[model samples]
Target: MIYTGFMFIVVGIIVLFRKIYLELQNIKIIIKIFKQQFSSTYRNNVQIKKQKHLTDLSNFIPLRSYKVYTIDQTTSLERLYMLIEKAGKTTKFSFSTYHDDESNKNYFVIDFIQPSSSIIINVEISKISHVLNDKLQELLSIIFYSSNTIYTWNYLSFPPVDFLIYDHIYSMNTDKINPKNFISLQHQFKHWYNRTFKHDENCQQIVDFVDSDGPLCSCPYRPCKFPTDTWSLSMAIMYTFHEHLQLNENPLEQCLAITKLAIIIEEGRNRQRIEALRSPSIHT
Candidate 1:
């Protein structure tokens, strides 16, 4: 009887141990799930905070109010000419272009800033026949000759060559167009650190402040190295404004971004000048 009682006790102990083991396993699974949930929540929170910070930073430079007019075959060049005439002859013009691969067409965009608002003119170039018949030459003359300042992103090869390419493709006469009048923003942005605007005979005229090519902003502890090549339009915009410039095939958007970048650069330079004037070192 004692042996049988001992056997019963052993069986009961084994069953109890098995139950305890299963409960411990259940607890471990619950803890693992909790840890995964906590990690996922933490990551989500971090992403949300990062997006909020970027949004707040973007507010530093407000977007300018501008109207975009897309001109195609249906639109009248006379109407566009009237608008251009109203902007006055001396108004500065920011120019950009786009080429659509799918449609096999070209786009020309012009942005003009006004006291009240800004205007963007986007011209669609479909065919050589349409380009010649639309009196586009007269419009080109008005834009090229009327504006004292013609701002292009890269005058060296990209946009400066655009005219020549167009001429080759359409056999358009570019004799009246003067190349010396075109100003390059890429050249300007690369040399933005010199404070004292200095240019040699070979250098194109910079619109506002001139600074040498180098990294402008960084932590004081560890300054960044100077860039080797000229900054592209998108890179310059991000550097100056702390904003991402979305690049696409839309010529109108490109013009707008270019114009805004120019404005921001001027404003930043003005602020720096004001700060310099107020500093004690200036009086010293």
Candidate 2:
């Protein structure tokens, strides 16, 4: 009987140690997976240049000049001359020229400056709708690649619409649409959160406690999941907007929101990192 009891105790010790060992191993595996995923988002160093030149042509005269220019002239000088002529006597203004040499397209920024205010127009070579759609797809692609790993890790039962939200943000900024629409979209996301986890008291409590400008506190019951794609999408949109608007609430606020959302998700899971590894799908 003594020998049997001793054997039972020994077995119990071994089982406990095994469980601890497995837990430690799981933690290590998770960390390793995260590092592998994180490195994939920025692995390729593609030297693509999307240059925008701000030209102060306030002193330049429109079509009255002796310079013979063609309507179809693709050269930078000819295009600049055409833009000046198109302004039609407007003075003291700023315009932008964009050259995407990779795509071989010319884009223009037509800004009219009155003494009191300024209005800028995004004049693309293509139709505005087409340009906006292309931008949205580009933004979505970035998010999709960035967050592919998180989707696999969680085995998400259904595809989340975070990518859509990302596209919306990019569309709003790149297409130069009214910012009120973006604000409305943000509110809509809050409403969706409310509906998705209405039954969970903890989630409801968290949602209720969220401040207007406070870091987004996701539903605790379902818990907000941060895939690498979500972060990439947010960053890409924020970075793109930062390039143009330089608005008071851009890039910084957007980046902060990303970081905060990640923390909230991580805290809810009692996990160290909120974002899963960058998706293998991302082209470095």
Best by TM-score: 1
TM-score of 1: 0.59
Summarize candidate 2's per-residue lDDT along 1-284 as a digit string, tens digits.
99999999999999999999999999999999998876664453222222222221111111111222222222344444444444433332222234446667544333333333333434345433454445433432332332121111111222224323433433433233221212122333333333433434433234454322223435432333432122232322222112122223322222223222322333342211211212222211
In lDDT terms, which candidate is top? 1
Q: Any idea what lDDT model 1 has? A: 0.61
Q: What is the C-alpha RMSD of each candidate to the true structure, in Å?
A: 11.6, 22.2
Q: How many backbone clashes does candidate 2 have?
A: 5
* Per-residue accuracy of model 1 over 195-221 as CA lDDT, tens digit each: 323333343332355333344433321
TM-scores for every candidate against the unseen true structure: 0.59, 0.19
